[model samples]
Target: MLIGCSPSYDTSQAQQVEASNKQTLAQAESSLPHKAVVYQVFTRLYGNTNTTNKPWGTIDENGVGKFSDFTDIALKDIKSLGVTHVWYTGVPHHAVINDYTQIGISNDDPDVVKGRAGSPYAVKDYYNVNPDLADNPANRLAEFESLIARTHQNGMKVLIDIVPNHVARNYQSLSAPEGVEDFGFSDDNTVEYAKNNDFYYVIGQDFSVPDAINGYQALGGEAHPLSDGQFKESPAKWTGNGSRLAKPDANDWYETVKINYGVKPDGSYDFPRLPAGFEHKSAAEHYQFWQQQDAKDIPNSWRKFEHIAQYWLAKGVDGFRYDMAEMVPVEFWSYLNSHIKHAKTDAFLLAEVYNPNLYRAYIQQGKMDYLYDKVDLYDTLKAIIHDKKSTAQIAVDQAKVADIEAHMLHFLENHDEQRINSPDFAGTPEAALPAMVVSTLISRSPTLVYFGQDVGEPARENGGFGQATRTSIFDYVGVPAHQRWMNNGKFDGGQSTEQEKALRDYYQRLLNLSHSAPALKGEYQELDTYQRKQNVVGYDNKVFAFSRFSEQQKMLVISNFDQHNGKQFSLTLPQSLLKAWQFNHTETQYMHDVLSQIQVVYPIETQADGTAKLEITLAPLQSMVMVL
Candidate 1:
């Protein structure tokens, strides 16, 4: 059983103080049981055959596209990056309506129908694969299966994106039972029946007319009459700006209908309701009906997801990348996990929950295995790389990172968010190296790699919203490029731009060291630095040195976090341990002697210890961990 701490403690602290008070804390109290790396893929832009043989392809407005030449080969390359899981963007069917013939994209412009497939988030159908991507069913499945098999063969797992929050506008019309008037209506009655009375539309009577600033619009108007069984006036409106009657509602997902969480007929607490449209029935009757529906439909959905997972798992899938998992409810995950655990208990489930505080609520529910710890990672990276904070501050950030790792996923970028390679983050390939290094170093959960991040794939043409962002990466298809280049290197092809290589090597070294050292693995203990002002950090168990210390194999790790090229400092060993010991740089494994008096060099020397008489400098943003 995976043990866990009380999900209530605050993790934002300067450092881990009161060590004696925390020693009795169990490893389960430190973090959750998941620790696997995840890689995110934007399937559309991952590869294209026609352009540079890169794994990305372009898409037009009407949703027509060619097979990305890079899918199969790119999958092979992604597996070699030492990641355990691969998260593909939504594979569900989607469609885009174009008002004109012109094709281009503009920032913050919603009406312009640039020739691009609308975002996959605007899901068209849940049951069918995107036609463009399903060119050769057998081949695609085989390729996907091969990917999964390879991942699992390498001891990994897989997860497919499932959009349960809302269905595509065409979905209800396409899949709803015949004569279902409840398909597209916005009224108190329909809303009550559809969402089980858990939610209410904010109307003019209850509140002032909502403005367009937040994308609010009136539903029933002179041009558009209210559908039957719906209120004549509603807050929902079609934001798509087309004659299509079934577009998602602007206020509450115009294309997708909100699900009703069954509430008491007396308008009290909420509960689950029947899936199929059934109203005017007693709560007991409704409960029984929903139970029957769940017994049949949920099993099928579960089997479908499981089969999708198996397809990749059979291909050697490393782990899972879950999307909008919080929307699915705990019951569904509990059922899915029971079976998935049988297949691979070690399989990582990296969920996407943007808010760190909300993550705690989910962890307490035990509904998920892990959540993306982006907030902490973001704070740490920004402070160190952007704000240029001190090592002590960075150490403080690392503690929070450790706390989040106890129960969430961590990464620099993923499919749902903008690419780190975007213009916002120094648009050049040079940005990737430091980004990768910082991401890999402080990642508490399994690290996540957005697709094409390794190869320096450019940001999607249009903020990654519609077709512009869905380009394919099949351009690099059938090419014999160095896999290392894909894993680590700048697009410029220069030796000075080898941040990827260094970071890649660093990751491998760290991961390998973690595998070999118990202290580095399993659970982490927040160490203490006697001099916070000096920006020096130390951990208990004499594990602070740059070497691994197994009873039979003692090692120490130390670092000079200064920002300059070559500076030196001295470290005092804890009085409890012997002074005469051998030390090795964690990355280089070079042996060095450490006497009672030790001197170390750093590139940027921001930390100075007046009491211990120690001063060290490190290259700008440079950090090192030594082993003794």
Candidate 2:
């Protein structure tokens, strides 16, 4: 007589076991903190409610978002979306077209500024906040300090940008502390290179602005006293991108000047080298190691940035987002970040290092808390979303950085990247559902969400100096969709469309669940290979599957990237996973998707050789986290 096998465990006792395990897992996760979620908002763009998106518009024509715009209501709304940190980009004083001459700030020559709003990376001053961002120009510092206190009161940390590799072409700090001098102030300008000199000079050539190109002229060819193609510099310094020309090409970083960090023209270091084996040590240890070295060994530029970071920290700013971090020497980061850690042990230090090869070096030796996971994970996911590649590559990319996954930060949208809903990208926000799920849940890395990403901002406005498909960081423009969520300063979704509201709700649910889930902090294993080996019908490159589990919880996450079709298949669990979970092939499991709250029951059938199989179904652009 033939007999069917029952489940190894009884369903009646499942709830008790799950409850006990979850308690244990929660306790463990408490010791190993959950991954952070960072919300990066361009300080100038986030609160701009003006709908008049005039091209190359002056600040009067197109309004600017002020520090007062981020009211308590706005901050609390942001905190409710499961954000732990708010990176206020463009806070530092940069060159601008507006006449701040009355406030002791000189008007930037229109020839040198990128747009009427100017580029935030070309910081004009380090000791002051952007005048454009304040409600009152003379009281700008107090206004910024109040904003900092408000952010802390709302229970989220604040982050500002620090561009150490370059400064505005006319960098002048008006509010420096007593006895402190501006960059290039104490340098001997006649030399090409020196250890203590702040800049590299060309000795005899005067600075020249680039000729107009692509039917574009400075300030739209409008006449201004300073726009006569003349800027006063006795000897030219190297351009921010290392162009030695007196007149840099329009494509070069022409608006800013490079800072010298003890590297000579021959590409040799004048600063002391970090010893081998230092990359694996803690930041405190790195600080101690540097403390024993002679202060004279450090470069002058490094000390200047150190003072700047300390100044911001003293104002209650929690951390920094280092711009073009790779452009500066890695050793400088080791020195700067270690010293910052010495002052505040829990300070968050994130960098934009694009080279995957240098990821480990920057994180370990440079003492950075996180580096952008762009070239590998983000690019692969993008290709898969457009069907240019397969889902299989995600596993390979994950394996490549398995050891340093925690130090890698993941995001689908940021200021520098095209919006997911833009015509040049996915063309529809719905198409990014699967990619967003994987980017937020597949690893222990922190997650980043740009301000307007959740509301499906297409970046359709052709703001001058920055084209369509990406929000303009260089011009005065309004973010239409984000303003809908702002609801005319109410900071509610009052004016948002139903579709936009639904998308934001999805983001809120996913982010909050990710923030609280203990199993996400545990081990991960890829399940696509096991399913493919069985040759299951409808199992294709458009679908991805993975599992995360701990002593208290286990979850199987699957996503379908195909926007036009659904997927149904028999998913097989490999022997390795069965061994890890200590579940026999005949176990009958009951689970539900924590995201959508859809309950499911699956009886895992055993093949003759003890392989387990469970059926799964996913709609177009749908992702599910089946938790047990």
Candidate 3:
């Protein structure tokens, strides 16, 4: 309708326009799922109200203990923390000898060896529930059902552990039939015993048989000696010029064998060759037979473990915490997710992918609903407390919070890492409050709290596994009186130091706030930091001073990252948009005009340049939030 005119822009203006567009797109992509919380549990050490001296049952090297002795008072206590999901660690059957008992492992010493129970990663059997975990192995379904039901009733979900990588050493699956000589296929004309060609990825340089004439030295008969493959200076050498033998892709790994991915000549992988006693058959027939009977395919291998997962879901479990998820094929996880969702629409899937690269792949595939975002948590915590970074840097770091919230599983500590209260940070009790606050409040995804974290427990060396950081809280051999040191603050002269009390109270308040405030509940936006001081960091948005805001609830959150005394600074508050607001401090109601200017004071240092600096504070770091 108007006169035909060609619109044109200056070169600089066009470039600026394009840059703005790209920034907007990037921001949109980063701001995804806004709310979630995760809680971590060491199932073995959590509690065992029913069992005695066997909290983890056979898995406990020091014998079993009562679940009631756990540091957590009750499931209700966990619920009070406002976590959305709970991840249990190591819930699989493992090898008794290889994983739990070995040289330097003593049966009498609790610190060195408690019993022959094994690490859950050993994975003795996938289909059967560990008998030690339940009084009646056949009734495992009932026990698991009750646990899931209780967890849901407490307003939370449960996720068990799963390992799908390598199987246990000395597993029964690889054993040859009784009295059968030359059981596998023969190759290279070396057929005195079973042919090695039938073994998956087994080659001349991969393994070595025991030379009976050489005192079985090549066979590793001493139980602790190096394997024959390890002694070879060629392809199997573990170090020196032949260090390539230790490569993860190597065809052999101790007794744990590798699987062949390439198709066999007969277009099958199950049956590569028939035994000397069996009649020769077509490759297809061998494949069919192996598929039906091979241990790697008998519903327990990495490819077939989904059936066991289905069984657990039917038993009322809601989800799983996949162990060593990085080692398994992504295709398997995709398959598992499809099957699990079909069975339970609300099923949760949390993968223990510690690496950022692997986690990104899983997130892109959507195979995992959540993953442990350790790197982000670690970096953010350091930036906030340790580094005392500038407000602008914190703002940049906080910008990633939205991305983390979308797919990350936040946690303060887990069994795999050192305890948060360890001396590495601040051994004093004061450190607990600040750690808990950051873990629970600042995170975008679900937050996890390890067992024994509520009450301080020192990390100790694992008995059989050398230098393990995690330790059990339940002391069986000693009387409750002797263990009084662990539970000091419960009564008088207990271990609940003043710092511990402050931390607990602080945690309780923060959790209550998270539950009560919609602004703090979900979705965080990184606002511009106007004052980029060393100690004081400030951010504001239209509705809130910080990036955290809730439009529907009409709430805004402003946090002070200053470590020391009060700081005087100015912020360009969006007055036109924030009309008639109330400041959230001590739950008080104040007119917006009455609090246009405010000052925050902490027990840290301050510079005249309006920068906030924190003091050499102990544990329970200081932080404050203002809500409008």
Which prediction has more favorable TM-score, 2 or 3? 2
Q: What local lDDT score does residue 133 receive in model 2, on the 0 to 100 scale?
A: 93
Per-model root-mean-square deviation over C-alphas: 11.3, 9.2, 13.2
Tens digits of lDDT, candidate 3, 1-628: 1011122546686567556644653464345333445567655444432223333233343443222332233556666656666765555544443222332211221111112344555454554444344444445435555666777777777777766554443223212234322211222223211213322332335333222332322212323323223322112221111122323322223323222222232333332222321111222333344444545432223234556677667656678887667654443454456556666766778887767656644643334767876675655554454434443444454455454454576665676666655665435434444445545555445566665555554454333222334453222211122123235223221645565555555555665565455555444543344323212233211111343555533333334433343333334333322332222223323212111123533232223442322222211134444443
Give every collision pair in model 2.
Answer: none
Give lDDT per model, in order.
Answer: 0.40, 0.86, 0.44
For model 1 the TM-score comes to 0.59
The segments of candidate 3 whose C-alpha lies over 4 angstroms from its true place after superposition are 1-36, 48-61, 65-73, 97-117, 135-142, 170-200, 204-303, 355-360, 383-394, 398-404, 460-469, 472-498, 533-545, 554-620
Each candidate's number of clashing pairs is: 114, 0, 32
| Residue range 399-482, candidate 1, lDDT tens digits | 654544545555655554544545554354444344444444333345666655554444444322222332222111211122
Question: If ranked by lDDT, best first, what sequence of candidates would result?
Answer: 2, 3, 1
Of candidates 2 and 1, the better by lDDT: 2
Model 3 alpha-carbon miss at residue 386, Å: 4.2
Candidate rank order under TM-score? 2, 3, 1
